[model samples]
Target: MTTKEEIINRLNLQPHPEGGYFHQSYASAETTGDKQLFTSIYFLIESGNISHFHRLTSDELWYYHGGDAITIHMIHPDGRYEVVKLGMNLEQGEVPQFLVPARTIFASTVEDAAWSFVGCMVAPGFTFDDFELFKAEELLPLYPKHEAVIRRYAL
Candidate 1:
């Protein structure tokens, strides 16, 4: 069995500000309005840590690699709530890949296992300027119905 530390060193992943380890794998050179066409990264999150609530200007697609399944909790712009499970177990309702639309507030967590390794690709590329992290206090009032989950993942 491979340990989380072994995978981290093997992938050369570094601590991510969003509560995980990551390494940018690719960034297209083609530009569209000064931004790359797309960008990708290897992301790993261990159990007991949350990704935190955040939104991006571009859509992101997540692909599962190995380890435990990850539960992605998303709050859509229209205040809709959804959970996407990324894993290899089709019988268990887990998907190998899932897309997160642009400007959607979302977060992920590894449930039931030690860690999860996945790849994320962002269209129009990812930029620090387009990222927004929310606080529990800020979302509590807006999403009163989802108060429990919001507080669980939000900073």
Candidate 2:
């Protein structure tokens, strides 16, 4: 049986070069073996990892574990973006998971100055081979600046 402690110790954690952060805890064999990694979770995004935007072939589901609230911004296939708030003081009973379809751009913006804890589960697993990061400096100017509106979406 694979225990959480064992998995935690075997986690294939990696840091993003851009900024913020993305530390992954894997449940599969990414650490060692011929086994396929089925699921994993990523934490924090102080600078938001740009690599996870385009290369991930599996959908990413995120849950806000801590913080005031947050907004989930998704970059559409047509190159547009949509913003959705996760919560404002989300209750423990409330569902915590936002799905970002595979191959789309996704990110979270905090509602306030607090640590935002997010859990991400990627179907079919995530590996360094399939992972790729890209910055948004070139794309930022093209999208509408609506951080203010996104704050309202944060719970």
Candidate 3:
């Protein structure tokens, strides 16, 4: 029964609130993070730490924590994404963050080292009861096979 403020204070993470899932990392006590109701963060690939592509709710948000570059694959109604890439021009000490909306399917890459980030589900908050994961099985398989990734999200 730890309060969000208490948890934030205990973790010593600032309100980085980047507005995007690629904003920051919440776990591992390594980077700035956000407060989520039911959403959870994950360290996808090791060499790249990429969180696969998947769908999301209309109120989901994400922030970037660490890494060199990330590639986001948006699932179109036609069963494919536009391959939107983010966080590629990030340099040392010049990190930036962006906010994300729901119904967005995306992914990130670390390449040289392990990268991580945090996320949040707004409105009713994220929960396993309201959580879903897209594994490309239900999606239209017509994109780069390696990019059709799926991750956990709250709707």
Best by TM-score: 1
> Model 1, clash count?
0
Sorting all predicted structures by lDDT, with the top scorer first, yields 1, 2, 3
Enumerate residue pairs that collide in model 2.
Answer: 20-46, 20-47, 50-134, 51-132, 51-133, 87-155, 88-155
Model 1 CA lDDT for position 113: 53
Instruction: Report clashes for each candidate as comma-separated counts.
Output: 0, 7, 23
Give the local distance difference test score of model 2.
0.53
What is candidate 3's lDDT per residue for 21-117, written digit by digit as tens?
2222332322222424333342223332244444455455444443434444455544454553345355533334444456555444444553333
lDDT of 3: 0.40
Model-by-model lDDT, in order? 0.93, 0.53, 0.40
lDDT of 2 by residue, 28-121 (tens): 7553244354675655543233223333667777776554455566776676667665544446433466777887655555533443556778
Tell how far residue 49 is off in model 3, in angstroms: 4.8
